[model samples]
Target chain A: MYLAQIHVTYKPSILDPQGVAIKDAMHRLDFDTVTDVTQGKYFEVTLSADSAADAEAEIEAICDRLLANPNMETYRYDVKELANQ
Target chain B: MYLAQIHVTYKPSILDPQGVAIKDAMHRLDFDTVTDVTQGKYFEVTLSADSAADAEAEIEAICDRLLANPNMETYRYDVKELANQ
Candidate 1:
């Protein structure tokens, strides 16, 4: 088995109203030191594959099709091989 | 400075179309063993503060405001103090 960790985030240039809202909330909550809050996503997946190569292929497919919105979001991933796999 | 690691994920009960699409993509890419792909987010922030208590307060503010979607998504976070801050 392989473990894949995926992250998805809005492009920095895009306007993130969610992030801005969070920043405003922080200011109101007395946490004045926090200057920015960027939102993103993460995924930890277990692959039933035997090797990293096999797992990478699968993970790439996942990112391309579902994990990322090619137009609005960008994704990156890391894969680790399980000892027992 | 303090560092915050924030993770956001879709509620387990919610339909994760993105995750499903990734799974299908994996299958098509010859990685049949990947059964699921649950997506989430992560954030690492450097705070301009000196203590964990202060940093925690700020990070909590961020979570409430922008880091998480309280309605459809769930979030969790971890904080660590940096040596120089």
Candidate 2:
């Protein structure tokens, strides 16, 4: 089995209202040093594949097709081998 | 300035409907090797601090107080020094 940890974020040119809201809140909380905030999605997935390359390809396809919206967001992921459990 | 990359995840005991939906989609797409999926949040923040330790503490506070729901999610972050951008 392999575990994939995915992180998805908005493209730099995109506007992120949620991130803005959080940044404002942080400022209100007196963490005024925070200049910018960009919020995104994270996913942890467990899967089995015949080879590491296959697992990575499957995950890349998954991210491109479902987990992220190509128009506004980009994603990256790390895959780790897991012991049978 | 320092960039903090935050990742928040639901505890193992928590339910993740979005993840389940994605997993189902993956299966429908014939990636049936996928066994489980857990969804969470990610954030990229830019801030300035006098020291790395201070920046980490500030981010930890932000996660605990605002970025993450203490009752449902746990968070971790990595801080990197920026090249002044």
Cα lDDT of all candidates, in order? 0.77, 0.92
Residue B82 displacement (Å), model 1: 8.3
Clashing pairs in 1: A1-A85, A22-B65, A22-B66, A40-B41, A41-B40, A41-B41, A42-B40, A42-B41, B1-B85
Pairs that collide in candidate 2 are none
> Can you write out model 1's per-residue Cα lDDT over B1-85, one digit (the tens) per residue?
7778888888888988887876676677666787677767677666687678878876777677766788888877789876763
- How does each model score on TM-score? 0.68, 0.95
Which runs of model 2 end up more than 4 angstroms from their true locations? none
Candidate 2's residue-wise lDDT over A2-83, tens digit each? Answer: 9999989899899999999989999999989999998898899999998889999999999988889999999999999998
Each model's backbone clash number: 9, 0
Backbone clash total for model 1 is: 9
Candidate 1 residue lDDT tens string, A3-69 = 8988888887788787777667767777778766777778878887757887888778777876688
Please identify model 1 stretches exceeding 4 Å from their true place: A83-85, B1-3, B8-31, B44-46, B51-85
Predicted complexes: DockQ each: 0.49, 0.90
Isolated chain A: TM-score per model?
A: 0.91, 0.95
Model 2 residue B72 CA deviation in Å: 1.3
- Report model 1's TM-score to 2 decimal places: 0.68
